[model samples]
Each structure stands twice: as C-alpha cells, then as structure tokens.
Target: MTLEQLKIGQRCKVKKVLAQGMLKRKLLEMGITPGAEILFRKVAPLGDPIQISLRGYELSIRKVDAKNISVEIID
Candidate 1:
C-alpha cells in the first residue's frame, strides 16, 4: 500500500520511495528510507498535508508527496 492510503493510528514500514531527483533526496535526508517504520499521526481538515511520526520525530508531508511513498502495514 502507499503511504497516502494509511489510516490514522496505523503503523507501517516504508517499502520504497517512488519520488525522483530532489524530492527523493530530500525525503531520504529527512530519514524516510526503505525499512523505516512510520506512524500515521494526523491529517489536516482539508486533507492536503499529512502528519507522521518516525525516527523519534514528527514530520508533515503533502498528500501528493506522500503518495510517492510505498508502505506495508505493520498491524
């Protein structure tokens, strides 16, 4: 499944990052890499940006960008 499809409170591991070039690099630099665990935290009312917790930090990502990340549900 894709990161964008995960429900709030779900936990998953990143399988792949489909983004290219700078976008991919930025995500990697921010600690989003294959095998990393991610927790779906919150979403804005409009659902444009998504909040996730990973590596002991919380990060907000745009829905469009979150779609580029592939993940597998943990539980």
Candidate 2:
C-alpha cells in the first residue's frame, strides 16, 4: 500500500518512495526513508493535506505526494 492509502491510526513502514529528483530529495530531507516507521494521524476535512507522525515529529503532506510514498501496514 501507499501512504495515501494508510488509514488513520494505522502504523506502517516505508517500503520505498516512487518520486524523482527534487521531490525525492525533499522527502528524504523530511526523514522519509526506507525502514522508517510512520503513524497515520489525520487528514484535512476535504482530505487534501494528511497529518502523519514519524521520526519524532508530525508532518503534513498532500495526498498527491503521499501516493509517491510506498508503505506497508505494520499494525
């Protein structure tokens, strides 16, 4: 599954990121790397920006970008 598909309250591990160039670098800079554990916190009312907890902090990301992040459910 992808980050975009992770349900709220679910925990997942990063499998891979399907982004390229600047986007990939940006994600990496934000600490989204393989083997990273992530918790799906919440999403906007309209589901545009999604809030996730990872690496000791919360990050809000767009669904479009989230789809580029591949993840697998951990719990």
Candidate 3:
C-alpha cells in the first residue's frame, strides 16, 4: 500500500519511493529510504499534512508527497 493509506498509529516499512528529482533527493536526505520504519503519528485537521515518526524524529509531509512513498504495514 501507499504511505498515505496507512492508518494512524500504524507502523510500516518503506518499500519504495516513487518521487523523482529534487523531491526524491530531499526525501533521501531526510532518511526516508527503502526498509526504513515509519510510524503514523497524526494528520492535520484538514488532512493535508501527515505527521509521522521515523529514525527517532518526527516529520510532517504533505499528502501529495506522502503518495510518492510506498509502504508495507508491519504486523
């Protein structure tokens, strides 16, 4: 499934990142890579930005950007 589809409090591992160019580079710089674990923290009230915990810190990403990430839910 895609990162945007993960439910709140869910844990998943990044499977792949479909973004390209600068966005892709930025995500990589932010430590979002294949096999990285991600936790769905919360979403903005308007549901535009999604908050997640990864690599010991929190990062908020736009829904548009989140869609570029593919993840597999972890049991």
Misplaced by over 4 Å in model 3 are none
TM-score of each: 0.96, 0.96, 0.97
Model 2 spans > 4 angstroms off: none
What are the per-model numbers of colliding residue pairs? 0, 0, 0
Can you write out model 1's per-residue Cα lDDT over 1-75, one digit (the tens) per residue? Answer: 899899999999999999999999999999999999999999989976999999999999998999889999997
lDDT of each: 0.94, 0.94, 0.95
Residue-level lDDT for 27 in candidate 1: 94
Ranking the candidates on TM-score from highest down gives 3, 1, 2
Ten-residue region with minimum lDDT total, candidate 2: 1-10
Model 1, residue 70: C-alpha shift (Å): 0.5
Candidate 2 on 18-75: residue-level lDDT in tens? 9999989999899999999999999999968999999999999999999999999996
Q: Which TM-score value belongs to model 1?
A: 0.96
TM-score of 2: 0.96
Q: What is the model-wide C-alpha lDDT for candidate 2?
A: 0.94
Candidate 1's C-alpha runs over 4 A off are none
Residue 26 in model 2: lDDT: 94
